[model samples]
Target: MTGRLSMGSGQPIKLAERRVFSDSFKPLYNEGMSLVERAAEYLDGPGRVEARKLSRMAATLYAAESMRLTTRLMQIASWLLLQRAANSGEMTRDQVASEKSKVRLDTASAPDNAIGWNELPEAFLALVNNSLSLQNLVRLMDEEIYGRNAGMTDMPPPRRSNPVSDQISLLNTAFARG
Candidate 1:
């Protein structure tokens, strides 16, 4: 989970094929849930107070950023829950992966210099930063556990037919051979 998995001889396994059933996944789940709870408590308590003191533009930006933060956390929480379900045997890997596909990992915060961004409390900012870090970790793990893709390169390409073009090409090949 640190970065690589290895065989008994220590040659690294392919990352895309890595599985999430290891004990290592538990720490990630704990950290993710902890962050989600902390973010929620802060937003509902001190964060509300902090937002009230911001200037008009900063307050507006704060509202928007808060929405983004909440949405991001929800997505992270969903992914963590699914991963836990898979780890706990509550759900099969295939079911978890299917549900995981619906969880979005692309949410991002505003630029540091965005309007009123500097006015946000440092604690709130820290939460945002931490959540982003967790999101990235989850995304990497998802790819590793699920295989980066379906490994479809071996499948035959889709056929495209143009009867006239095929006939002309056939004629060309025959004549050229002669």
Candidate 2:
């Protein structure tokens, strides 16, 4: 039998913050809708199930990434606004660096099998990458709007997946046992 468990008070779990502002170039979400619409046009009834799954995946990844970038951008923008309001004269370098630290863009490695290296449609990897890049650009532009460095942004970490290797290793172990 399943029952709910209550824990004594402890440090609260930290939830990721969500951004409230809407940006103009919302590519990830808009493109997902487009993909869903296109797929729906070609499919019917049960066939739509697979298409819907793809669309949902696309939209979810897009939203997750967009939210990350948007949050960063908002922080940066707010910092800039605060600086402008408080400063009676030009800002110093150290002041700028401190504010910039709040919006640090950390690179994350992607799954290797994210997309086939050489293939059309390319497992939707291109779409994912493109969406991420656009998200970064949006953040960068916000920084630029506030008169910050728009140069030499770090590249995203490579994406890799090992499902094939994992499956093969499992098969080899099974065969050896047999």
Candidate 3:
């Protein structure tokens, strides 16, 4: 299903038949998957030992944060897999669009001033931070590609300033200085 998206100019831009999931997306996908795997390993190994040694409040926070981290990673994985499916033509853009609704892109934030935050295991904190970062990246991409949250209306197109001409102007100025 094709739809027109306005780019703040009241002009309707036709959605392209083929979406370009650029080479950059591959790195993001890889990073997200790697983070997920690393988080799993840590949670199963070092994280478990660390959690057991935590104070009562800290242990509770640890459980909450770890669960949030896992949920965030799952969402990221879902987004990446959906994009890969669309890229490979295993799934159509329309199919991906519909399936996108099922993935929860919104992250659950931990309380900013939680009592045990300072006492949480450093390794767990690192994993949580990394997962949150990945989640944000995936969420941005989802909004951009899927037009989530009226993102099409909110996002402005990148401004172009004729890079070749700009380069030539720079060169002219440099040569004139000599």
Candidate 4:
């Protein structure tokens, strides 16, 4: 069934029209995959060299941050793959909805300790920041499309009363005066 909602003007607005998953999903998929590749390359190459040059404590922090970065990217990749399947009709909307529970998008804040943060390679930090930005965007889309609080906005549209029903109620009340 087509996902359509009636507007105040009595016109039906297609949900897909408002946000075509294919249109936005493709770019996100490409960008996400590319970033993942870039991160992997940097971590394995220059990142490894940089980490080895750091002090023991800083090296440990680098390792932890690298793991976190990879985990975050994996989560994003899983979500994107699911969306791609749904968009391509390989999976139904219901299937996608059910599978969504399996994918947890963590929004944990970045490390606050400045002890070894500055010691981290600038490239690694840039990747982390980029991943965070992408994660935020994905979270927003997920909420808009599937969250329990979907369709709710800060300012609601004005309610339209049915004039005919109001008139009928008024007539009924008047005729009952007999």
* Candidate lDDT (C-alpha), each: 0.71, 0.39, 0.68, 0.68
Model 2, span 40-134: residue lDDT tens = 34334433343345443333333333343344334434443434433423555456546655554433323433322222133344444644454
Q: Give per-model TM-scores.
A: 0.75, 0.29, 0.72, 0.71
Order the candidate numbers by TM-score, best to worst: 1, 3, 4, 2
Query: Which portions of model 3 miss their true places by more than 4 Å?
Result: 1-20, 150-178
> What tens digits encode model 1's per-residue C-alpha lDDT throughout 1-178?
4567778998877553244576776777788889989999999999999889988767766776677789888988998888778778899989987887778776766666565679989999899888888877676666666755322123221221444543443344435532
Candidate 3 residue 75 C-alpha distance from true site, Å: 0.9
lDDT of 2 at 142: 38
lDDT, model 2, position 100: 51
Q: What is candidate 4's lDDT per residue for 141-165, written digit by digit as tens?
A: 6765786323333422121145454
For candidate 3, write residues 1-178 as lDDT tens digits.
3345778999766443223364556777788899999999999999999889988766766776677789878978987898888887899988988887778766654653565779988778888777776766666656656666522233221222454543443344435431
Model 4 C-alpha RMSD vs. true structure (Å) is: 20.5
Top-TM-score candidate index = 1
Give the candidate number with the greatest lDDT.
1
